[model samples]
Target: MRPTVLITGASTGLGLAIAKRLLETERYHLVLTARESSLERFAEAGLAPSEHVWLRPLDVTIPSEREEVIDEIEREGTGLDVLINNAGVSYRAVVEDVTEPHRLAQMDINFRSPMELARLALPGMRSRRRGRIINISSVGGMMAMPTMAVYSASKFALEGACEALWYEVRPWNIHVSLVEPGFINSDGFERVRWTELAHLALDRPSHPYHRHYHDMTDFIARVMHNARPTPESVARTVQRTIERRRPPLRVPGTPDAYLFDLMRRFLPRRLYHELLYRSLPHIRTWGPQAQPVMRMAPRAMR
Candidate 1:
């Protein structure tokens, strides 16, 4: 029998791409879960019954809902062979601009829920003495970003939890892997923008930190508009991770990701922070006419 693979957050983006790729192989049965909102859309995507695509309506952030999903899966299948925790949320808010609830919500969805799901899956997997857990982390987790403070915190927490759990679970023959994609094609940023813009207080009196608030939000929007790594690329990396006999603890999905990691390691902390700040649009503002003048500066000075 083909091994059953359960993937959370499979409504779209990297999760959907991974499901699509995995289905083509004919070697694994797939169980995909997302909120009810995505069901009709996914059904319209034309996935056939023979594809072995089982859809479960689940909100991973809710403990009861997640437990129900686990129960349903157990009733319908033999046992889970792999679990991919891909569901996540992002927000374009600096630390001071964000609310306490928003930060906790991100942590709930991105870190805690995934950990809980993994906890639920362990008993069965340990009994079978085999399993694979692939965590879809981000470069944001490894490095800080001006606007994505809360999102980074959640992902960073997830990375730490997964890394430590990797050691504990290896004895049970379960392989745990983290995939950190630099910038993948997803609705994450758009959602962030919509929420931030909707919640922003336009008429409120400006404060010392208000300039940063707008710049950071706008920068996040521009980044979302300008560059996005293909979901297929991340899907391929995930496939490789699952199939490889010896996968590393972390697989960064982009050259930029690896480059930044190297830079963080080799550069002094102050120098790295300065360079990073200069590189990010939020921290470096230039007038429309300023670019041409700046471009003419000496190569080193520029």
Candidate 2:
């Protein structure tokens, strides 16, 4: 039997591109999951139903659904050879304005679900004596940003969990790798639905930080439009990571991701924080009114 690979968030973006690339190889059976809403888009994009690509409706944030998905995989009697945790979202919210519900949602989708999925998949992979877990993290995981505090925090947690799991599972011949992308073209931003508090923060009458919020949102909107790397680039990297005999514990994607990583390592903590604060218009000021969008804002780490 071919190796079975399960990829979360495969309905679009990097996950979808990876699925397409792997399908061309015909070396593995693929199981993919995304929200039910993505099916039409996937179909419209010309990905037909096939024995090679099995699509399942899953919102990984829900525990019962995750368990059911795993159970169905088990019942198929196909051993999972690789698990790619790529399902995540970033909410553009400041610390002060992020509501409890929104914060929980971000945490559930970006960090908690990945950990739970790994927890469920690891035992089976260990029993098999050979398996791989590739987590699709972001540069946001490595450093802090201005408006995406909650998102960054979640990714940070994910990075910690995966790094710790690497040592724990190495004895079982299960390779764990983290793929961190700087910015990829995805609906996570374009289709980002802000929470009520975020809306209030953006359009608040008494908002002390309105200008900062507006500037951050403007920068994010522009980045989403023009500054993203191709999903295919990320897909190729993920494929290479899986095929490598000695894949590193972490793989950084995007042009300057490695450079940024190095700088973070060598720079003084205060200096790094200062650079981040000064670079983002949102963090440099507090405001009572929405400010004009700045067109020359520098590209973020994403």
Candidate 3:
């Protein structure tokens, strides 16, 4: 029997790429879920629904919908061999500026939903004594950044949970792994929800960080343009993880991901902070402007 794999958020971006790569292997049956409209779009894009691939509508934040999907999987007798928790959303804003609702929304989709789905799928996997649970995390989970605090927090939560679960399920022959990718060129950026507070602040020049907001956004755009990895690369990482009998608990989705992880592990706290800050075009340029004021201060002040 072909291994059955279920991937959430499979209509576009990395999820879609993973589905395509896995289908090409012709080694596993795929169960893909997305919003209804995205399912239509996927079909229109030539990945039309078929027997080997099961397409279903899913709003991961909804418990009832998740239950329905799990029930269907059981009814079909396609006991899941792999569960890819790829469904996630981002909310970009400073920690202080992020509203309660936006923070909760990020946690709900990125952390809570995946955990719930994993819980539902574990029983079957335990019974079979073999399975894979791949959690799609981000480098932000390892190292948080400005304007990404809330988003990173959710991924961090996921990493911690998955890591603990890995130990607990090892005896059952169930493997849990985290796929951490750096910036990826995908529809994810377009889907990001900027907090209302951040938006309002950007509209007002008098706001303390108004200039910084535009500067950061522009700097991020440049970085993404120059370094963003392809979704296919991430998909390939996922495929490899599934094939390996004893894969590492954490895997980098791209070469740059490996570099970033190394830096985080080896660099000194102060030096790392300085290097990270200077890497931003806005911060580097702004530093020189502040030097003159510092030089002009009274000798006692200096």
Candidate 4:
């Protein structure tokens, strides 16, 4: 029997790419879950689930929907061999610009849902003494950046939880891996979920930190205009992680992801911050008197 793999946010972006890659191999039975709108978009794009694939609309943030997915997985003959927590959103703005509800929503989709899914899936993994939990984190997970405060916080929380889970479940042969990718390109930058308040602030130049927000948005647009390391490549990393004898605790999905991780671990703090600030040149536009500084921001490290 083929291994059963469950992927959240499976309708688009990295999730869709991962699903297609696995479908090509025909090595695994896939459970692809995403929000209804995303699934509709998937269908509109001319793709549908095959015999080996089970597609469903699931908002992982909802406790009942998450439980339902686990229950279904438990009933399957193969049970669950892998769980990919790929559902996530990034809110663009300064810390203050994000409303409290939006702040919580970012955490809910990115950090809380993944953590809870792991908690639900672990019992089954432990009972069987085998399973793989792969989280689709980001380069921001390794280090924080300007205008990404809340998003970074969410990933940071996930990274810490998964790291601890790695040590605790090593004895059970339950492999946990964090797949960190850098800036991923999307259609109209759908992945960059700018908060409503932040959007409004863009037109109001009088708004405090307006320069910071616009500069950051322009920076993201510029970088994403030429974003590399396709989603399919990152998806392949997820598949490879599952097939490993002892899946690595952390898998940097792109070259920049690896660079960021290593630099943070080895580089001196002052030097690192200098590089960080230099790369995020818009961050220098903190004060009203500061002019927008736009050069080739750090391309590789994201």
Candidate 5:
């Protein structure tokens, strides 16, 4: 009997890439889920109905859907051997401009929903005495940035919970790991742009911290271009993490992710902040510069 693996956000970007990699292995039968619209992408990616794969529509933010996925897995009788919590959303606005609804939405998708799904999958995994839980987190989870407070907070919450879960589940031979990736050259930013918070607050020029938001956008775009963590690359890391006899607690999914992890571990808070700020010209404190939006909003953000 093939071990069953469930993957959230399996329609595109990292999720699609991971699905492809796992399917190639033929070692595990995958239960892949995404939004209803994205479910078709599985067929496009060659993950059609087969003994090796099962595709379903899942919006992780919904509680009923979470229960439904786990319950369906139980009906199969084999139980879940691996759970990949890959569905998450992110935006890029300063915390000052973040509405309460947006903050809760971010937490729900990135942090809470995964925890809830894990709660549903745990009983089967615990009864079987073996499982793998992998979360696709970000470097920002460890090192928060200026316009990334809300997104980072959600990831930080996930990392904290997973850290405790790692210790708690050791006795059951359940391995929990975080695959932290840096900025990737993927369409994920655009997919999440529907959120007002994800953009640099260029429209509201009167808003404080306008200059900081303006400058940081260019800085991150450049960083992503230089970074080597593509969706496919991260997928490779995820595959190896799952295949290992005793996987490490954390895996850096790209070179930049590895560097960020090192920086977070070795650099002082003041030094790290200084290095980051120096890269952006106008990203200082909320002083006089915040009163004006000097440059045009990037065409992408607009």
Candidate 6:
């Protein structure tokens, strides 16, 4: 029997690309899921149905929907061999500007939902004594940045949990991997939510951090555009991780991701902080500017 793999948030970006890539392999039966609107968008993109690919509408944040989907999988006796938790959301704002609702929403989708899904899938995987779990994380998980506290916190929590789970499940031959990607050309940014206070603050010229916020946003856009790492690249990494007998615990999904991971691991805290601040246009200007000084010849020589 062909192995069965289920991917959440499979309507667009990395998740969608992963589903397509796995389908091409013809090694596993693919299950792709997204919200109803996302599913419609996927269909509109001309992804026709096939015997091997099953598309389902799923809102990962909803508990009932999650349980129903898992129940269906169990009833079908497909016995999931791989579970890819890729559904997530992000927002940019300082803690003072973030709303309670927005913070919780990020937590629900990025951290809680994925954990819950894993809880449901664990029993079957443990029974089978073999499986793969891949969590789509972010470089932010390793290195937190301004205006990304909530998003980074969610991912950090996920990374910690998955890392521990990795060791726990290894005896059963279950491999857990975290795929951390830097800025990729994806719909994730387009879908980013701005807290109400952040939105209002950004619009106000009197706001202390308004200009900094604008510059940061622009910088991120430029970086993502220039780097241009496609979702296919991430999917390829995920595919390989799933195929390997003893896959790496963490996989960097892009070149930038690899670099950042290295810096996080080996760079001195002070030096790393300096480099990171210098890279951000907004933060770089926060310090005193160096005045140019022309040196005259020594008085005796002159």
- Which lDDT values do the candidates have, in the order given? 0.76, 0.79, 0.83, 0.82, 0.82, 0.82
Model 1 quality (TM-score) = 0.86
Q: Please give, for residues 1-302, the per-residue lDDT of candidate 2 as tens digits.
A: 87888889888888889888888899988887888887676786667778777888878888887887777776784877889999887777678878888889889998999999988888788888888999998899898776778988999999999999999999998999999888665545655546666666666535665666677766766675675577888888999999998788889977657867988999999998888777786454555334444332223312
RMSD list, candidates in order: 6.6, 3.7, 7.0, 4.0, 2.4, 9.3
State the weakest 10-residue window (summed lDDT) of model 4. 293-302
lDDT by residue (225-259, candidate 4, tens digit) is 67887888888888898889988888999888888
Model 4, runs deviating above 4 Å: 282-285, 291-302
For each candidate in turn, the TM-score is 0.86, 0.89, 0.91, 0.91, 0.91, 0.92
What local lDDT score does residue 156 receive in model 5, on the 0 to 100 scale? 94
TM accuracy, model 6: 0.92
Native-referenced Cα lDDT, model 1: 0.76
Model 2, position 100, has a per-residue lDDT of 89
Error of 1 at 122 (Å): 0.6
Candidate 1 residue lDDT tens string, 1-302: 88888888887888888988898898888988888777665676566545477888888987887888777767778788889999887765657667777777888999999999999988889988999999999889899986578889999999999999899989989999999988654455555531243244321223344445445555555564556578887898999999998688899876667888899889999999988878765444332222221111111110
lDDT of each residue in 1-302, candidate 6, tens digit only: 88989899988888889988988888888878898778886676566677777788789998888888888777885788899999988888877887788889999999999999999999999998999999999998888888788999999999999999999999999999999999897545656677777676566645665655566666776677777788998899999999998999999988889899889789998999989888777564432532222221111110
Q: Mark the regions of model 6 whose C-alpha exceeds 4 Å error after superposition.
A: 284-302
